[model samples]
Target: MAIDDRVGQAGSGVRRDLRDALAVLAATPRLLVALDFDGTLAPVVDDPEKARATPEASRAVERLIALADTRVALVSGRALKDLEQVAPFGDEVLLVGSHGIELRLDEADDVLALDADERQQLGVLEQVLDQMAGTLDSVWIEPKPAGFAVHTRLASERHSRVAHLVAINELKAEAPDATVRLGKDVIEFSVRSTTKGEAVEHLRRYTHASAVFYAGDDVTDEDAFVALTADDLGLKSGVGPTAADHRVAGPAEVASVLSLLATLREAHAADAPDTN
Candidate 1:
């Protein structure tokens, strides 16, 4: 069920449910807070460089990180360099980029390495997508490490549909084994099949988190949502059919939710018994 829009209300049943979940997550030995950068932490924008996390959301992330047994990560479709450019965070939060094709555990971590075969495949993919965009008004190609995404966010309805159709047909003929993913106004074709779900699972094991709180706002995020289990909470940040357990209107509501989690986590930490 959809909760209150702001999540700033007091004594609402929906609020209580979310509050309880956050409390349980806080009390876990290790809690991993994973989020989609675009449309989840920041408002969706045509110019990706313009997107930045809401102030309240940024504060909440810092607060949660200060608390014991807490970790935060940004799982985004942007390339690692692109994600880092927009996200004003340091090494404090892990970053999973390119829909899990790239992972930035820390600044010192090695970059993604591709073999000769993969490099040749990427070159061909880029050329086809480049041609697709050159022939259509407002169609754009976004480069990634393993593949590229055809962005139709700026295209007219007819042009957008034509771009998608052409991309699909061309991929079937040119790169039959390429993995394709559909998102809001975009279609991504990857040489390597990877997903946000795999990234989240990897983070879970890597951090040894007892519970995971993940939020996202696109169809591709369903891959991550479906990966969630009873110990996890999946939140959808926009209007669409979703596998997420909860829904919010948009980025503003997401900020409120994160702020609430920060509050609940602080209280839970205060109440816990001392192990020492």
Candidate 2:
């Protein structure tokens, strides 16, 4: 319940509160472990394409995937195609990309379709972002299926501020009703409305999970954190401002959390009676 709040730690370095929470979560009839990709599972990098999950994190997720009644997922702000290129585990982990606008449930999942009006709105959004980004150095635009994100991670302080300000104003003028979200050094605009919170709710209902574990690392992640019910656990990775009830240092600590959950879940599954 209390994630980042300091409490006594065991020899394992995990807080007593977290360990107790995990123990309870592991015993639930169904569990959903959903996470944000960037900065949560993979370390945030200047070049988003090169990002990958840490070795320990990969092993931890694999372990969870092997357990019965447990579903693991990576919910991210990146477009599904871009996310697929950098994120680990392929179909082994369920994916909610484009801030929940896209879902890859299985190999047979249908692609997202844009109607005529939505397609027109996206075209206008992309053009505004690309043109605004073209005017600045080290500022670039990333295209998504329903919208685009303006990345200023590589820009100088002045250029970054300018990029963000210009993008916000332009989107306001061009796509007045579009969904706009600001993240760490990134400003995103989408014609279709969605959020990580929506993604979490979707996953929870889809899996019929009695308990959920969610971790994230950015402001956009607040959406997901707030979506969590009391029965769910929210861990914030890295720091700044967050709605998450618990906090972990960064991707490494996140790996530890996952590994711990995997271990606890493994034991619980073993002790579960054979219903067959």
Candidate 3:
């Protein structure tokens, strides 16, 4: 589909859901805007370390952060340290990494700990994944504190399928208790049970937000999308079946959505009655 057509479809939801979402956000006393990093704010890249937010997305987030009673956050499946490197927007933007298992707000960093048995199982799983990667061309393993990921983004389609199957079978045999999530061209396994849904809920409570706006572009992001309530907005940045109420073609359209939200929020703030 054409980019404009996709964006139009996103903006024109069932009976103006987007419009209603924006209106609620504008009048909300406290707002929490959380976005997925990869494929939401930034395009996916071969080198994961090379990913960065698009200029438009960066500017829109900055504008949102500047608005009164508005908080902006990046929630991702990446490790906290890796996310910190990719999204270096300082302390203003909250960071939820490791698929909500790791959180960094301001200087405080909270990471979930794995018990000895879980750690041992993860280690075995990692070793098996490494062995499996050696057999498949262009397949690599990403080590994480909770577990690890098998990445096949650069592999051929057939090879990717084979590698993923092999990895899943091995993970099932070795660490059946591990939580597995499939996204794009990657399969992530974690010993801890956490989801972007829990992360968004935590942020909502932490910020005491009256309304929330979350945007993402992956299967794992469906957790965050499902977390949204009537008072919140969920945006899907790419195509495929999703729980998001709205859809945008890609990062550019996501930027436009955020920009509009920031503009509306700023106007609302300006028009609010002053208690002072």
Candidate 4:
């Protein structure tokens, strides 16, 4: 369906709520806008490495970055390096990956360091995931800095369930302290305990943002949504039960939201009286 058709399906109440959220974001002195990568800014593809932001979304992001006092960030479950390969935005935008365990701020890069024990545990996780992948057709394991992810997007329902069960059980037995997160057709195991919520809070403090706007599409993003304050806005890109204040159809709608925010912020900046 066309973007306009999808947008037209939104109820009046949702439109009003989105308008109100954009108003608060536009008026804030410093604004932080964080978005999830796959399935939020970009359509989730069969091959994770092939994912890229839609052209419309990319243009909207550029506009947001150009706005004064507005900071844009992509907080994703992919590794920082992998996210960089896909998005490839300039230093003006922040990139948080591996669910906040890895951060690339401006020109500096920060990653979670694993101790000897954690390294050993991660090796075991990789072995277990490899074995599970071997057993299940179309299931693949993605290695990460802290741990690994089992992707079942292309697997049959039965195979996906069995693979996830095996991986989860193995992780519980081998790396009992590992942080496990379940999302759409994927299961991730990491040694670090960081969450997207923590990442959002960190960005908010780092940027000294008066208000924040966060959007995502997966269950993993619920953490970020819950972290939002009264002054902040949370948008769920797709549907299901979510903690986000508003819901949009998919990445297309997300792009529209970004465009709306950029337009509103530009207007607010134009209307502001010059202090100098």
Local distance difference test, candidate 4: 0.87
lDDT of 3 by residue, 122-198 (tens): 88888888988999999988988798988999999998999889888988898888888999999998888799999
RMSD of each: 3.6, 3.7, 4.8, 4.4
* Comparing 1 and 3 on TM-score, the stronger one: 1
- Winner on lDDT (1 vs 3): 3
Write model 4 residue lDDT over 114-217, tens digit each, in one string: 99988988888888888889988999888889999889989999999998889888889988989999999989999878999999999999888999999999
Where in model 3 is the C-alpha error above 4 Å?
A: 1-17
| Best candidate according to TM-score | 2
Better of 3 and 4 by TM-score: 4
Which segments of candidate 4 are over 4 A away from where they belong? 1-14
Instruction: Score residue 130 of candidate 3 by CA lDDT.
Output: 90
Stronger candidate by lDDT (1 vs 4):
4
Go through the candidates in order and give each one's C-alpha lDDT: 0.85, 0.86, 0.86, 0.87
Task: After superposing candidate 1 on the true structure, give the runs of residues whose Cα lies further than 4 Å from its correct spot.
Answer: 1-14, 274-276
User: Looking at model 2, how many pairs of residues clash?
Assistant: 4
Question: Comparing 2 and 4 by TM-score, which wins?
Answer: 2
Worst ten in a row by lDDT for model 3: 1-10
TM-score between model 2 and native: 0.94
